[model samples]
Target: MSETTDPDLDDSVRIADPSIDTDVIDRIESALEEGALADGPEVRAFESEFGAYCRTDHAVATSNGTTALHAALEALDVEDGDAVITTPFSFVASANAIRLAGATPVFADIDLETYTLDPADVERVLAERDDVVGLLPVHLYGLAADVSALCELADEHDLFVLEDACQAHGAAVRGDRVGGFGDAACFSFYPTKNMTTGEGGIVTTDREDVAERVASYVNHGRAENGTGDYDHVRLGHNYRMTALAAAIGRSQLERLPEFNERRRENAAYYDDRLADLPLETPTEPDGYRHVYHQYTIRTDDRDALADGLAARNVDAAIYYETPIHRQSAYETVSTAAAELPRAQRAAETVLSVPVHPALSERDRRVVVEEICDYFHNQ
Candidate 1:
């Protein structure tokens, strides 16, 4: 088996580093001492701080990004028989969350350059289906989706828009942060993401109704202003974030801007170094801030290039070798047969290298040199 397939056989440059320093440890210890481990003061503080950072009126913390997405969908009242239009070129979680909310995910193509939802294809999807009540656009690889255009299209159709900012913690579209673009946005704090919350996520929204619904949905559907603690008014799940995770998230949130800047710097270095190569580097259009979650590039010879990088002990992985609609889990979905040529082509050609903040100068140099040498030898 190839090193990429066999984890134990791989010894390459680190792709991500979720290192927790003494500050994070101290926060966790403090949270533990507080004796409120489940959705207490720490979680509330993190939500408030994150909301302020996103420039949104409300932010609700959840156990993970998937749950965040689901909570946001439920808060929007998207349920059985309703359909949502979204790009298929993303992690399965994007689609799974739609399904978990009792809605079907309608497939759309992506912009080949940004690898995000194509508003034109979204319009085509909307024209074909009247059941698409919402639009879910994933900010793939830390680049903000064209939320402005998507939201405009949604407005014409009177549909709600939800942003999947799981990979784009600090990314912005037209100078405004991603989380405030649509009706609501979801963010992931996975260790590999721009920020680490020790496994947590949050939903940001300007609407108080959406915020209140999401908060209730994630906490066993407890009534926000009920008579007692067990007053469950609606169906919900136990997707609340722990105090420890919230504590860590608070510290990470404080450093997210710095971390994203380093990632952008590393991506710029790659862009300059790999300019003359045979591949197409990432694209950051005017007014859009790309946080460089994965510094992905596109090459027709993607498989051979990935193998070459592995041989040199450098890490290069496919972000989504299979688009969501093509996955076995979505085989039975009607959108599986949708003709998303751009998304399908991206699945075959896209490759993501190390662009994390943890990468050193030498590490970046090594990655560039290996790729240049690979092309030279060919």
Candidate 2:
């Protein structure tokens, strides 16, 4: 693992470590040697392997998570004046993607316990709105959102469901992976994510139409079965994944199971050690496999706790200090922004410490010790 530490933190324990082992290097080297740097066979193979991993029939590779999301929304035909119900308590990208697709993102309160979209609130939004055309639930911090219930609601309301599974690559609910739950799901391979491809993303789905549309959209709207390479069909963007990123992604995918297991183990250790502490540890609902992209804890004194860790040279960070709806950009875009009290509270309290797969025993111990010392001393 090529572990990176922050010099400003004085070699502190990292919140995440993107493992670029020899396998990834070798794959990239091979691609470089063959001059296969463009969107080609490597991307195709990665898509195939990733689709199989996610239990989906097709996976459309893209330049990054944001593009994957935009492409998916476009494929669903969510356009101007259409509103999509989504959680406000995630990385802004979740809602930003909807806005980028020329649609309005309607805010819904989250279930504070899970830090994910609350189906009840979603239903309420659906009840009050006539413009809602889709559901975009984010699997925040590697916990699978209650997609099953959300999907059922979508069925009743005749709305499309697209999961923002960017933080939940390997997470599952009741033995089934997240990508297959909704109409389509998106995964990110950003450096800090559970896995890394330098930078890349993919859309996983069983629907052939969605897959086809995403593929074309990512490739400048070129017709799949067009007579010529330059034949344009619909207006699209250059969101295609490069061969180098795909090569790294394929290698990372092979190691994802092991990486996720280590994260789970570290989280389990935190759960046991932090049980009696003042802060609230993360929860894994029954039969759900939480991949622990961020082992976040909630406490009213979140800032103090984070400061304490930083002073001790232990890296701790906030995943989303500001909920999407509260951002300056979304202030006017979403009408329900002020209605998400749970999301507002979560933004002020949640702090994620070092729980990446690459953390050493000493690193994890320091994290737990510093956190415990902070509360105990207080």
Candidate 3:
């Protein structure tokens, strides 16, 4: 990181959002001309490398993150009316994917400190509906969900475990990577994510059938066999990744580990400097390696604090103002049966500070000082 300058005195304490634009104008153009721009060898290469990185036996590339989640559900054969338990404190795709897969998304309250699905709440849901076919635990803000305990509970209930590791690329729990923690893990390569493929995703798993189903499903059900060249093996989707997107992703993947490391360093600086404030810094458990995708903290006076930061040209904002279960899109959901005091409170108070790899030391210091000033004035 760079050194901090006073808001009134310095010129470039401003932080730039980190992400690489697809500079392969030539590659994309050439591929488009050649008509080999669809899900070709480039996508295959990305999937193969990504699978190895995740320590999974197979990886299926998809058109986007949501498709990746839907494919995972379909691969597991999640049925209509079957409940797929997950956290409401995450991106809408977590629950929307379940609904799209013909299952009801059973939302559980999140742990206040980690903003992940609370295991106890999961147990509560399971106690009532033991027919849950899958559990999609999201590793929010690059912090690993309590996978060990969650897996234990899933095993107890005989439910399949899937990981929504979209925001947690390169993040690990107890030395095991997020993709390896569940029966299958889904990753997003969206532009704002820690890493990107321009626009694509990868689904990792160890099961042969699941991998095959995912491959066929994403490519118009083309089985890797002879006869009926356009044969449809299973009810499938045209969710294949393009070669151009995969090419960009290949470059991005090479840089992801270092990018995550920089995020961790910025988080450590915030953790040390913001300790005296009313906010609670994100916690990285002893065995968990948090990549600090957003470096979020909670303040009782969130709006005032956010305004203060904005006045200084520091862009801090709330990630989720409403839990998924409480959203108008899901108001009819039954997951809100019990009071979600934790999720509601987190929604009110939590705000994310910039923690992208592009931050300079000066940028980080300014952020910390402005936050400190917010507390002192209170």
Q: Global lDDT of each model?
A: 0.90, 0.90, 0.84
Off by over 4 Å in 3: 1-16, 21-35, 225-228
Model 3 is weakest, by summed lDDT over 10 consecutive residues, at: 1-10
Worst 10-residue lDDT window, candidate 2: 1-10
Q: Which residue runs of candidate 1 sit more than 4 Å off their true CA positions?
A: 1-11, 225-228
TM-score versus the correct structure, for each prediction: 0.96, 0.97, 0.92
lDDT of 2 by residue, 1-378 (tens): 466554545557877777778777788888888776778778889999999999999999999999999999999998899999998888889898999999999988999999999999999988899999999999999999998899999999999999999999899999999999989999999999999888899999999999999999998998875423898899899998999999989888999999999999999999999999988899899989999999999999999888999898787899789888778887688574466889989999999998898787878889988988988998
lDDT of 1 by residue, 67-141 (tens): 999999999999799999988999999999999889999999999999999999999888899898999999999
The per-residue C-alpha lDDT of model 3 at residue 58 equals 92
Residue 190 miss distance in model 2 (angstroms):
0.4
Candidate achieving the largest TM-score: 2
Instruction: Show the lowest summed lDDT stretch of 10 residues, model 1.
Output: 1-10
How many residue pairs in model 2 have overlapping backbones?
A: 0
- Runs of candidate 2 with Cα error greater than 4 angstroms are 4-11, 225-228
